[model samples]
Target: MTYIDQLGASAKQSAKVIATLSTATKNKILVAVAEELLKSEEEILTANAKDLELACSKGKKPAYVDRLALTSERIIAMAEGVREIATASDPIGIIDTGWLHPKGMEIIQKRVPLGVIGMIFESRPNVTIDAAALAIKAGNAIILRGGSDAIYSNTMLKNIFVRAGIAAGMPPASVQLVEQTERAHVRELISLNNYIDVIIPRGGKGLKSFIIEHATVPVIETGAGNCHLYVEKSADLEKAYAIILNAKTQRPATCNTIETLLLDYELLVAFLPIIAQKLADAGVVLAVDLTCMEILNKHKIIAEHATSADYKTEYQALKITIVAVGGVEDAINHINTYGSGHSEAILTEKMAASDLFAQEVDASSVYINASTRFTDGAEFGFGGEIGISTQKLHARGPMGLRALTTYKYIIRGNGQIR
Candidate 1:
């Protein structure tokens, strides 16, 4: 058999064990994986150093390097993420409902793992451990395919996590990272629908698109966070300042960071002077629309008229597009047209306005007087996440253990056949 075939067969076998594992046993295994990540931090860092060196040699962008690098603190967080999952309630066998049929059959639908999940991610080594730990907790086997840029780090993490899970009595093949990093590997991996129940890609638009377009197996489209934050005419200015600043600058490199700011025309003058200075001080480039340019006409803030394309782009940097909307309803229409459906927020204190925004925004998560950053799985108390999903089918928002499983119907019949 070919290499992927062997791995697929092993994962398929391991899925049987994963599906039947007791919650307590699964928790112990997940905890063990966390401990292993902590114990192997030094080794993981050593492996990561190799990747960083290569990335630097290739002159990768600062943001790219930041995502690829690992620190002692980051490692602890990765391990803690696993422990958090261990603490969550097991979702397996929770009956959706039970019904009796006219033909004397009783049927119940219950949660179960989605068999084998194939994760194709970019250069975030931490995902290596996070994905595996979550798979164990959710009772699903995982096949990992990380980018070539993070080969060393992913390889090291996969080894540590899988070894720990195996030692804790989990199936040996429960977590498998692709041994090769060639582009061809991903092409092969995503085509294996018979073995891979789902293909989840976690990265930029390019990576997410590649998998969604090419994968023969089921694919989950994750967050591309062209997220927006709107300031209604009646918004609390102080609250808007805090929420907008946090959402845009707290971590601009993250998928949840706000990329566009929709302002009510009535609030434009009042918000421009303050929000402009804050964003400029934070080194953010304001890609303004015509109305905003006129509003900030004399404010010597770092500003430029926003290009039409800026509204649709996911600027993974300290930059934002500012556009003026006629009102709250117009704001909703603008967002629904341009938003990526990842996360959106409104910094309004008006209960009516907040209700309108929350109800009308077409996003995975909508917020009132809050930052879009809370769209994260960990922030939502899901321990960690496979990724923030943007699609409607299956799951949306931050995907935790519960999102990793599908349901099965168990029917008990008394010799009845139609």
Candidate 2:
């Protein structure tokens, strides 16, 4: 049989074992896994070095290799993330709702595991640990398909997890990795919807769009962030400038980085130039609307006239497009129209406007007077995450253990005539 066929069979059997395993058992496995990660950090780093060397030799960009590389600090971070997730309340079997019918029938809507999750992601090698920990803790088995760039590192990581699981008296097959990193293998795995309960593609737009288009399995499409931050009329100038700079420049390669800034007309005259100058000093390229361009040009802040295309762009760099909106409503409309529904924030002193913006903006997380960069699973108290879900279907926000589950109706009834 093909490797895909063998993987599908193992995953199907592992799901049954995991679904019946107690939470305590899962936590034990997590603790052992964490211990293993710490013990093997040097070996993991050695494996990561090979990937880094290959990436550098292939002339891959620095940013790409940086994401592909792992260090002892990052390995410890991943291990600590596992411990945090293990401490989280078990999401499985939680009764969401219950009701009793007039005919002496009791019904319970309880959360259950998704059985087997086929997770395909890129760049970040730490996802191997995070995804495996979350899935096992939530009583689900997983099959991981990490990017070819991180293949060696992830393979070693997955081996550690399996060894830890088996040593902790858990089924090692509860976590599996696709040994084959070919594109065709991923397509084959995605096609096995009957064995794999769900397909979660966590990467950039290209991979997400490809999976959504081709995969028959139900997909949790993740990450296409053109996030925005609007500085409203009543926004504090200092706060707006600080938040904008931090959101746009702090880890600009991330999906939560602010791609656009909306400046309200009332504050445009006073606040625009000040913020523009600060950003210029920090070496941020400004794509400014006509009003902002006029203000910046007068103040000797280097900027260019922003086009409509700028609003739709997700520049994963130290660049941001600035636009002057008529009011809060216009800003909201702009975000809803062009934003990628990932993370949106507004800095405003007006409580009512902040509330309205938070409610109206269609995003996984909306912030008031806070940076959009806070829209992360760790920030949301989930420890770590696989990715942020941009779609509104199954998972809508930072995908933690709860988001990895579906519910079933656990009904109990006595023998009685209807």
Candidate 3:
């Protein structure tokens, strides 16, 4: 058998033990892991240094190298994130519903573990702590397959976390890491349906699509937020300026970063120039539709001509596409058809329009007056997330500890016949 197959078998066996573990024990393990991460900061940093050196030699961008470089401060933050996850409410055994049958049986549906989870993520060693924390807290074993870019960092962090769990009286196998960063290894892991109960793909569209198309395992596809920021007719112009700037430039590498700006036609004469000019001034490439283009040129606000493909692009860069919609309904239609079905927001003071947009948009998290960046597990008060699930089945939005769980029916009867 292959190495992945062997790892899968071990994880499957360990998952049986994890599923039956109590919340207290899980939290104990989490707390210990956090403490260990703090104690082992030097070791972790040393490992991260290797990754940084290698990344620099390979000519990786500064931003990319920064992601791989874990400083002392960042290590503490990661530990605290894990500790915060430990303190979140336990998701297991929550009674979804309980009812009595006329035939004299007590039927209760309770949350249960989801068994082993396979998580594929890109460079971000902090995800190592977050994934392991959430998986253990939710009573599920997880196998991490992180990007080769942060190989040394991930390897060291995973060792610390798993060792800490083991020292804290949890099975060490419960938290597994695929040390190999080969693309073939990722494909193999995603394809292991029998052992991995669910797969959480946590990167760009390319990674999510790869798992979606090839994985026989159930997947929670995350992060293809080709998100939007719509400026309504009654929107406060200052609010519009601040919101759009924060959404696009706050962090462009993130999935929730706004890729499109939809303006209500009624506001075109009044607010388009103000919003467009600010974005352009900030070095944001504005891809404008023909209607908006005419207005921009008339006002001498330069912009790039938006093509059909522009609307569909997830520009994880300093860029945004501008489109003019007739009204709220047109805005909703444009979002529903072209959105990646992640997060979409409407900047409207009109309660009715906001309500309608929130109700009609079919994303995991629909925003009324908030930025799409708020579409995160930690922001939703779940501590930290595995990632944002754009898929509709198992979980949606930022997948917290609870999203990693499944439900089971528990029935009780006193020698009753069926």
Candidate 4:
């Protein structure tokens, strides 16, 4: 058999052992993994250096480089994230609901892990530990297929995570990574329906599309964040400015970063110039609509005219598009048309406006008077996230431990017939 097949088979076997592992055992193994990550900081940084150097040689954008580069602080943070996730209560075996049937039967809907997740992601090496810790904590095995750009970083991180788990009495194949950084390996892994229970793609639109189209296994779509933030006329401009700036420039390369800004026309003439100045100071390029350009020009603020393409782009960098919208309704319509159904926010004090925007916008996560960046799983108190699922199938929004599971019904009866 081929290596991919072997990996799948081994993971399938290991998932069974993991699903039955006690919560205490899983937590112990995860804590060990966290400790191992901390211990291997130098080794991981060394390996990550290779990827970072390669990225620089290739002339990747600064934001892209940030995603690839690992600092001592980032390593410490990744370890902390792992430990925090380990502390989360186990998601498995929890009864969703229990009831008595009409025929003297007891019924239970219990949560269980989906065996062997096949995860495809890019750039961020921190996802390596995050994915492994989350998968194991939720009692599922995983097959990670990271981008070729991050191959060196991913390999070393995986080694630390998997070995620690196995040493701590976890399943043999609790976590595995595709060492080969080829598209062919991804193709093969996605088709292994018998082994991988669910496939989650966390990258660009093209990568997610490729996996979605080719995968025979069930797919959970994520990323491609053409996220948006709207400023209502009644918004507190100070609060709005802070939220927009933080959402756009805090970590501009992230999926939760705002790529589009919609403003109530009244706010457009006043708040847009102030917002644009801050973004410009941060070296952000503004692609503005005619109405926005007119107001910006009035305020002597320079901006490029927005192209149609800019509206739909997930500018995973220090760039954002600006548009003057009629009101909350106009903003909602625009978002539904161009948004990636990831995260969207409305900065407004009016409860009516916030509620309307939240209700009408078709996104996995919606916010009022806050940054779209808070859509993150950790921010939502999920510990760590698999991804912000953009699809409306088995899961949506921040995929925490519960999202990694499927439910099974157990009916207790004395040899009950159908």
Candidate 5:
């Protein structure tokens, strides 16, 4: 058999063994893996250094490098995240609902593993542990295909997991990483319909699009964040400023960061200048529509003219698009048109406006009087997420242990027939 075919068969076989493991066994394995990760910090850093050196040699952008690089603190946090997952309640084998049938039968729905998961993500080495820990907790085996830029880090982390997990009595091949970094491997991995139950792709539009077009197996779509932050006319200026600053500048490379700023026309003249200066102070470049540009010009603030494409872009950098809208309705319309359906937030004091925005915005996560950055799995108390799903089919929002599970029907009958 070919390389990917062998990986697929191994994962498929491992899934059955993992699915039968008790919750305590899974938790024990996860905790062991976490401890091993902490103990192997130096080795992990050495591997990450190699990847970083290659990324730097290729002249990768700072944001890209930041995502690929790993520090001691980050490794600590990664370990802690795994421990948290161990602490989370296991979802497997829990009865969701039950009913007695009129025909003398008992029907019950129980949560079960999705069998095997195929993860295709970008250059974030921490995801290696998060995905494996979550999949094991949810009683599923996983096959990981991380980006080429993070191959060294990913391989090292996966090796640690496999070693620790097996030592802790977990089944072999419970977590497997694709060593091949070639583009064709992605297609082959996703196309393993008989082996992989579901494919989760976490990356840019290009990667997601390729999987959607090529994969024969099921997929859960994680989206790009062309997220927006709208300031209603009745918003508290200080609160709005703080929320926007945190959402845009705190970690602009994240998928949940705001890419667009929408201002109520009535509040535009008053609030725009303050936020513009604050973002500028943080080295954020602004691309503004005509109305916003005119106001910024009066205040001697410089900005680039925003193109139609700018509104639809996920900057993933220290840049934002600014626009003036008539009111909540107009803001919602613009967001629905340009937003990526990931995360959207509104800073407003009026309960009515907040309610309207929360109810009307088409996104996986909507926030009021808060930063969009809080749309994280850990922040939502899921330990760590496999991905933040934007599609509405199987899962949505920050996918935790439960999101990785599906349900099966169990029926009991005492010789009762139709």
Candidate 6:
């Protein structure tokens, strides 16, 4: 059998053993893994440095390098995140609903593992630890296939998880990383429907589209974010400025960061100059619609003219598109037309405006008077997330432990016949 085939078979076999583990046993293993991550800080950083060097050699963008780099503080945060997952209530085997049938039969629904999850992600090596920790805690096995850009960092992190888990008496192969970075391996991995129960692709639009189109295995889509922030006329300018600045500049490399800004036309002359200068001061490149461009020009600010493509793009950098809309309805229409259905927010003090925007915007997470960056699993108190699923089927927003689980029915009968 080929390498990916072997990985699938081993992961499937390991899934059986992991699925039967008690909550206490799983928690023990997770805590041990977290401790190991902290203990192996030097090794992890060393591996990350290698990947960073290669990335720089290729002349990768600063945002791309930032995603691939790791530091002592980030290592600590990863370990702490794992420990938090261990402390969460296990979703496996929890009864969802129980009832008695008309024929004196007892019926119940209980949560269970998805079994042998396949994660194909890019850049961030920390996904290695977060995905494995959540899968293990939910009593599922995971097979990780990270991008080539982070191969060294991911491999090192996987080794740490394997060592800690085995020493803690967890089943071997419970967490497997595909070291092969060949693009063909992705197609082969996704085709193993018999072994991989489901595939979760975390990357750009191209990666997500490729997996959805090619993978025969079931998928829980985590969308590419083209998030937006809308500022209504009634918004508090002070709060709006803070929210926009933080959302766009705090961490532009993340999926939740705002890529487009929709402003109420009534507030264009008043609020646009203040916010535009703030963004420009932070080295943000502005792509503006005609109305916004005119206003910025009058204020002596330089901005590029926004095109139809700019509104649809997920820049994932220090850039934002600004558009002036007639009102909330116009803003909602623009967002739904161009958004990836990820995260969206509105800055408004009027109850009616915020309510309308929240109810009408087509996104997983909608915010009012808050930064779009708050759309994170840990911030929502799930410790950490596998990914923020933008799909409507199995999951919607920030996916925590429960998102990794499925449910089964149990029926007990005493010779009841039709």
lDDT of 4 by residue, 1-418 (tens): 8999999999999999999999999989989988998899899989999999999999988888888889889988998898888898788989999999888799999999998999999898899889989999998999999999999999999999878888999888889999987689999999998799999988888898888888898899987799999999999988887889999999999999999999899886667889899999998999999988988888888899999999989999989999999999999999999999999999888999999998899999998888888888898999989998999999999999899999999999987676
TM agreement with the true structure for every prediction:
0.97, 0.97, 0.95, 0.98, 0.99, 0.99
Residue 181 in candidate 6, Cα distance off native in Å: 1.4
Residue lDDT tens for model 5, 1-418: 8798899999999999999999899999999999999999999999999999999999999999999999999999999999999999999989999999999899999999999999999988899999999999999999999999999999999999999999998889889999988889898998898799999999889999999999999999995889999999988898888899999999999999999999999987788998999999999999999999999999999899999999989999999999999999999999999998999999888999999899999999999889999998999999889999998998999999999999999999999978
Expressed as tens digits, the lDDT of each residue in 1-418 for candidate 1 is 7788788889999999889999999988888888888888789999999999999999998889999999999999998888899998888889989999999899999999999999988988999888888888888999998889999999999889878888888998999989786788888888997788999999888888888788899999987889999888878888788889999998888999999999888877777878988898989998999878876777766588898799999998999999988888998998999999999988777899888888988999998888988988888988889999999999999999899999999999989999
CA lDDT, every model vs. true structure: 0.89, 0.89, 0.88, 0.91, 0.94, 0.94
Q: Give the alpha carbon lDDT tens digit for every residue of 323-346 in model 2.
A: 999888999999999999999998
Alpha-carbon deviation at 188 in model 5, angstroms: 0.9
Off by over 4 Å in 2: none
Candidate 3 residues 1-418, lDDT tens each? 8989988999999999998888889989999999999999889988888888888999987556666779899989888898899889998989999999888899999999999999899878889889999999998888999988888889989999888899887886898889977799888998898899988888767888888899988887888989988888888777778888989988877888899999988888878898888888988889999999999999999899999899999988888999999898999999998998889999989999999999998788887777888887888999999988887887888999889898999999888885
Q: Which whole-number lDDT from 0 to 100 does residue 10 have in model 6?
A: 96
In candidate 1 the C-alpha lDDT for residue 370 amounts to 85
Of candidate 5, the 10-residue stretch with the lowest lDDT total is: 265-274
Candidate 4, residue 163: CA error in Å?
1.9
Lowest summed lDDT window (length 10), candidate 4: 266-275
Q: Higher-TM-score candidate among 1 and 3? A: 1
In model 6, which regions exceed 4 Å deviation?
A: none
Cα RMSDs, all models: 1.3, 1.4, 1.7, 1.1, 0.8, 0.9
* Candidate 4 regions with alpha-carbon error over 4 angstroms: none
In angstroms, the error of model 5 at 192 is: 0.6
Pairs that clash in candidate 4: none
Per-residue lDDT of 1-418 in model 6, one digit per residue for the tens?
A: 9999999999999999999999999989999999999999999999999999999999999999998889999999999999999999899999999999999999999999999999999999999999999999999999999999999999999999999999997899999999989999999999998899999999988898999999999988895889999999999898888899999999999999999999999999989988999999999999999999899999999999999999999999999999999999999999999999999999988999988998999999999988989888899998789999999999989999999999999999999998
